[model samples]
Target: MDTVETLGKYEIKRTLGRGAMGVVYEGWDPSIQRHVAIKTVPLTDVDDPETQEQIARFRREAQAAGRLTHENIVPVYDYGETANVAYIVMEYVEGPTLDSLMKNQERFGLPEILRIMKDLLAGLEFSHERGVVHRDIKPANLMLTSNDRAKSRVKIADFGIARIESSSMTQAGTMIGTPTYMSPEQFMAETVDSRTDIYSSGVLLYQLLTGERPYEGGLSAIMHKVLHTEPLWPSQLSVTSPPALDAVVKKAMAKRPNERFATAAAFSEALIAAASASAAVVSPPPEDATIIESRRPVAGPVAQPVSVPVATPPKRSMTPILAGVVVVLLAGAGGAFFLLRPSADVPRPTPSPTVTTPAPIPAPAPAPVAKPEPVPPATVAPVPVVPRNEAVAPAAKPAVSPAMISDMFAQITATQRCAFIGGSVGNNSEAVLTGIAGPGARDDIRQTIASHAVPGTMQWNVANADTVFCPALTLLQSIAPPFGSADPVLALTLADNRTTLHDGDHIRPRLTMPNFVGYLRVDYIAHDGTVQHLYPQVADSSGAVADKVHEFVPGQKVSLGDPSAGQPGWEVAPPFGTDMIIAVASSRPLFTRPRSTNVETAATYLRDLDAAVHAVRDGGGTLVGNALLVDALAK
Candidate 1:
């Protein structure tokens, strides 16, 4: 493992590079006498539980890239795993990476840029058609070289994290891609297809033209811009570009996948066309010219010009010449038909018929009017209407004040009120609810208002908490057991609201729970069906639990892998799937016993345990504020 002279049948010359996951070495295949690059993981990680998971993904990358065959894609020859290391052999591409090229300030010409992009897209098209998505498509992953004739050659490298359609390698809520070049869908943690690559390619094209990224800043800023901002045009970035190029960039980088080009092939065709059109219109066009044609016939013979000059002393009227010239011009042109056409061409008016005078007649007598029937009066009743969240006005006037409404909410069971936000009925009967926890929370509050307040007056705006709060709420519901009340609502806020975790990454969530919680427990469900109790072990006999309840922490921050729990903080492990975190709170001690097993091979506690912990159980008076362990965990 220490700078070996050879790996299998290949002779290692020197190390190419090293990344967090593995190492790349420049080697030679003795069998075919061809230069090959060997990629392998460190011998030390083959034993670590977390590293084993990454090695599996590393092998998956080999499988995904090995199945692909393209001129522009890096070719994989062989892959194998030893007792202590995993290695992949591929063709050694000769040239600097696109990242290196960009750093050298090597600006590419329009034609060269087009060619490189077309080849890159062609490779992506091949992979996508085969149901493989190269999630990470950035300058660092692209290899570039210029031939002796100045023609650029591009090869896409490092399909180490590519997603295969049939693989199921990644989880549903988990995101995997570089943030800078990621698509809007990737940022939203949505399932992606080939269009994601198209978005990244658009970013690359913009960078190629202007020598800068379209969106630049921190991860949050980039995400906000990607989701809600439109990038500047190439022409606006000081690049002398044509309108067609701007159109291509705008369409290719559209936030929605459907709005972008459907396939990489389509993206390539548009890119080629835009680049060519820009090249053709580099020069200015010529000015306009005018010509006048004379329609007079030359039938008359030439007249003698003798003494006519002597008669110039007599003034000539120029108005007649002008009128004659106008007439001649109109005749020669199409206007002559309207000015000199015969009467047959014009529409003729029809003649009216003659009328005879009528004879005198006698007048008739007027008729008498009948009496109207008497109408009966009837009584009408008003319909009682309730104000819901639908923006409709309530028929009945709201009787409760803002303080009264808040008090009524306080009376509801904490479970029922988990998703409720404090709301008030205005003097105009409009109800505005703030601090709504999630999207579903709006409906809960609306139902509560309809039951207790005037109908058609409640309006809850969830826009403020939606972006960050909804995702965690949805995640909690998806993984935890069903609960009765929304109370004991647990809001887990990640240090940056980032859900994506990697090897050696720590996840320290700031948790917000109800004030009545006396005891809390946290657990983790990994992708491999193993459940890890992340906090509050049942074996801890210390009085720390009682002390924690005595002190009410509004926003308690703790790492997932707290050393006190005898485990590393929320470090990412292998078999990458949608890993979940569960938290339970109760007024009394949990009845079930906690299990401690190997960190990597622990069996799931909820798998077949028919106890109260597996599902929500009514704790009766034992549970505080009507929320049981399941209700608390549901947060």
Candidate 2:
């Protein structure tokens, strides 16, 4: 098949990608001075009004996804239809889908997956909030844009199968979703909600946490397990996998929507907690802990998105052949008619690790492992510290600031795509370090939280989520509305979601891997054997640092890293004081009126994440929208 010469003004560059819905193209927008992605759906093997309607749904998908504009959510630039083809114009993101990551790595480490989950959650939250349900939240739909890109670009893609959960899903009756990742209710073709997406997300995460699917079998067998069987706990899949992750997978794959998280943000928060716990134990590794996480920095060529034209999508084909409809879920029912079978024919679960592994295995959390041992390796550089005048030490800054906490909340909510705020709660096991813990240990918890915050990173580590109940209560009384409304998505109460481990059970959630020697710009330690530090050439991409600002005035012209004002050693005092980290918002809605691919489609949405950041900073602890809305995108 030869490539098409053109689509409208876009000169077809090449076929960038393809999916079940349509083909994507890399095209040149000669007049626009930039590259654009064109998605077009062509009429394929079909006949009759029924088939036409199915194609119509594809066109409608273009209409739906084109309206959204969040960073994590793909952006639709334009839409139109030819007599035989329909197309859409969009921003080409740069990276492979989370599916590629999982495929490449078998299972992603907890930290990387957590980061990916946050991005996906933010995009989903935005869509869900805007009356859309992705309907298919599999890894294939979630793209991983480089955080290092000039645009800090990250996005979720492929919303062709989305349906308006509030109404459309019922009539659509579309049998959508990958079997291994499909929520239990999806197989039944039952009424679904945001919870359905949650279930799928859990399944995908389970696969990411463990190299294997929770219940692996052929298509027919997997469907049977999805419909009527439970899954093995994540810990059971890999002894190195934290048991804490088990709850997350279970919650995400819960049979009932009510049993799952109410929003993508909630699930993300749970994931963050798991990561934090894992990090804590890894930092100062527990004795005899098995190696977990990677020691080397991540490496891969960033996948750049090529824009394609929007085309009329095929109508929703509500009926698809489900080959395994009655293989397992109804197996026992069939046996009732032949009740003469002996009791010995039935299978009884025995209590061996192998036997237990086949079912809902109770994977006990490992002794805190997966964290790298503290090393004098040149890759993990020492953190910089700021010296302060003892006279002003008490006034230097508060251990925790309301604004700092608020900023963290905003950034995490945006980036992690959770409506929840993450900080350490003041709680710890006073048992004086019984055995070991994972990355989620209190110490590693402090370090990871420390990674993002400077002076006042609030923490809920070494403590239950209730430890931060004071702030939770404050947020309830002062923040926004609908905290306890019918949606209940933003209920003020924070869910601990941590594994309820017995004493002596080494538990943590930090992901420690070796660094990459490729580039040494930044460093973090890991526990994985033979892990190395990885860094890219930042010297060329970034400008040389300017002189540090001596004053704290807003928009001051001073550059970062001022000469250690009075003393040269001041910068190395300690990592805790005067360190600054950038925070970007990452949260999005979990529900939407119509499912879509555009990142901006959520009920409460941000068309531009970069813009949202400045608005948030300017608002100074106030809502970033309203009068703050500018005329940039409107033009």
Candidate 3:
């Protein structure tokens, strides 16, 4: 090997680090006036088929990572090749890799651990949605950057073995990943997906929580454990670990892919939920119960008792009629005893004191009584009891009249290009108007709506549009008025209950059909000018069902894009701005013909949707729709 000074336009300054296959150098890009990291792999023998394949893979790294645009992902700036070497130029991230930190015995608090996982999952969600699966997800590839607020920001690097879903570069049955973090399926040489990354992330999380990897040993040992054994729960290893966190790790590292979280978003949500649960104080067991003490096993031969609580039955009072019957029977028995006084004298001789343990008394069954009249149902439904330490859904806000909100929204749409007003309206009116607009337009829209509606009802979630989203603003304005009202028959909300999101954020849309029973369809209108079908992913396969309608019953809540359900959630990506998710419930199928593709131009989708809405209306079929606007910003 010879000393190299440069590769293409990147001036190689000095060596930064060395890997198995290549050396990374801190380089300077003159044209961009910025620092870059140059990774160069030597071409020892170009004619060798193996070398040629390696070159292809090296280029594929650039292609796979280059397609992704996210704050948590280290972006590829350029790719070039010399006669004897090939190189990739990427953003120069100045920070320590998570692997290095861990090796140095650096400790991570719960907040820091969560932040790292959030950023890592966010990056994976973005890349996975774009059809790239990072086969190798390890601490070595995660770099930590400090933000202006001195918070750690994670950036994922080294997509060398990342497999693009649409590409056939990597063949199936090729075992290519770190054995320590490889998922069970990966070890079996099976096809991998986003869940593979999830498993690896779980391993990283386990390490973070317990200061040790779930499986540690030689290759064969790790493989056997990952395939057939379950690691000790996080709580078992670390006393400070919460039981909820143990559940999260177990599910994330489930042997089967289907058992794991369906999407990175769901995994992230579970982590947040676990944190919340761990923070909550656990309630004590009820009184009138016998409880045995048990303790979690530690690394010793000490024996501990298993804890089990037994409930005591409540005592019941005898009814007046039953008590009178018992009294009459006792009086009859006393009279018989008086008649047989000789029998009592014979028993007195055998009355020697004998001590014995009394048999345990069994609880008596209640005597049946005459049936009483049925009671009418209560006006308000009784709240169902939730077990201690379990999550409780927030109570739904009081319903508001849609007509008032609709009229107020109509006034705001007269001028603003990217404006959407949603929420409820009434004495307890609460609405949020979100979109991309300038300061003047936002103020004007807010002021106009605030005057007509309640002063505090309107919440403005507006942001200035960047160059990428400027054109989308015009398109949004041209679209027809959103269907349904502030109070919709089918309600939709983000699973995390957040309206403001950032790059790599997961979008889990939850739908509730409280008072409606019909087929449902959900479409995501993105800031990138594309409308993607989010529900009933495809038409009926056998054509047995004409409408391909997915039926939704009243009082049922559906979490769309949940990976645990074998569906991927929508992940926020580039062209950050405002986006809308439209949900429609119809008595019949809205579109009889199957769509050629799930995604189409916004104009085409709206045109089709408008026709469908009108057709349903003309046919006198029940139809309802609702829209939720979210602001997607750069992290």
On lDDT, the leading prediction is: 3
User: What's the CA error at residue 412 for candidate 1, in Å?
Assistant: 50
On TM-score, the candidate that comes out on top is: 1
lDDT of 2 by residue, 1-635 (tens): 12677787777888888866578888778888788888887765557665576576766566567666776788777777666667788877666766666677543444556666677788778887887777777777776565342334347676766776444533535556677787766765666777787787787777766555565433433444465446546654343456677787888888777889999989999887876675221222123322211110001000110111111111111121111010000000000000011133223223222210122223223321011234231111222222222222211222333332332332222121111122221222111111111223344434533443323323231111111122111111112211111110110000011222221211111111111101001111111111011111011112221111111111111111111221111011111111111111112211212212211121222223223432332233221010000000100
Candidates sorted by TM-score, descending order? 1, 3, 2
Please give the TM-score that candidate 3 achieves against the real structure: 0.45
For residues 1-635, write the lDDT of model 1, one tens digit per residue: 54588888889998999888878999999899999999998557466887877887788879989999898899899997776678999989877788887898665655666777888999999999999999889999988654331555788988877888987766456667888899988877778888999999999988876666776534543554576556547654322344478889889899889999999999999877776665433222112111111111101100100011000011112111100000000000000000111223222222112111112123122110101112221111222322221222222333434443333332221122223223334564453433224335545544544443322344433222222222222222222211222333334333333344543344433333334434445554443444544444322343221111122232222222222212223344344433444454444444444444323232334432223321332232112111001101110
Better of 1 and 2 by lDDT: 1
Measured against the true structure, the TM-scores of the candidates, in listed sequence, are: 0.45, 0.44, 0.45
* Pairs of residues at least 3 apart in sequence or in different chains that clash in candidate 3: 262-563, 262-564, 263-563
For model 3, residues 390-447, the per-residue Cα lDDT tens digits are 2332222223244444333443442343332222234534444433343355556555
| Number of the candidate with higher TM-score, 1 or 2 | 1
Give stretches of model 3 more than 4 Å off: 147-150, 280-635
Model 1 spans > 4 angstroms off: 43-49, 145-149, 279-635
* Model 2, TM vs. native: 0.44
Q: Worst 10-residue stretch by lDDT in candidate 2?
A: 327-336
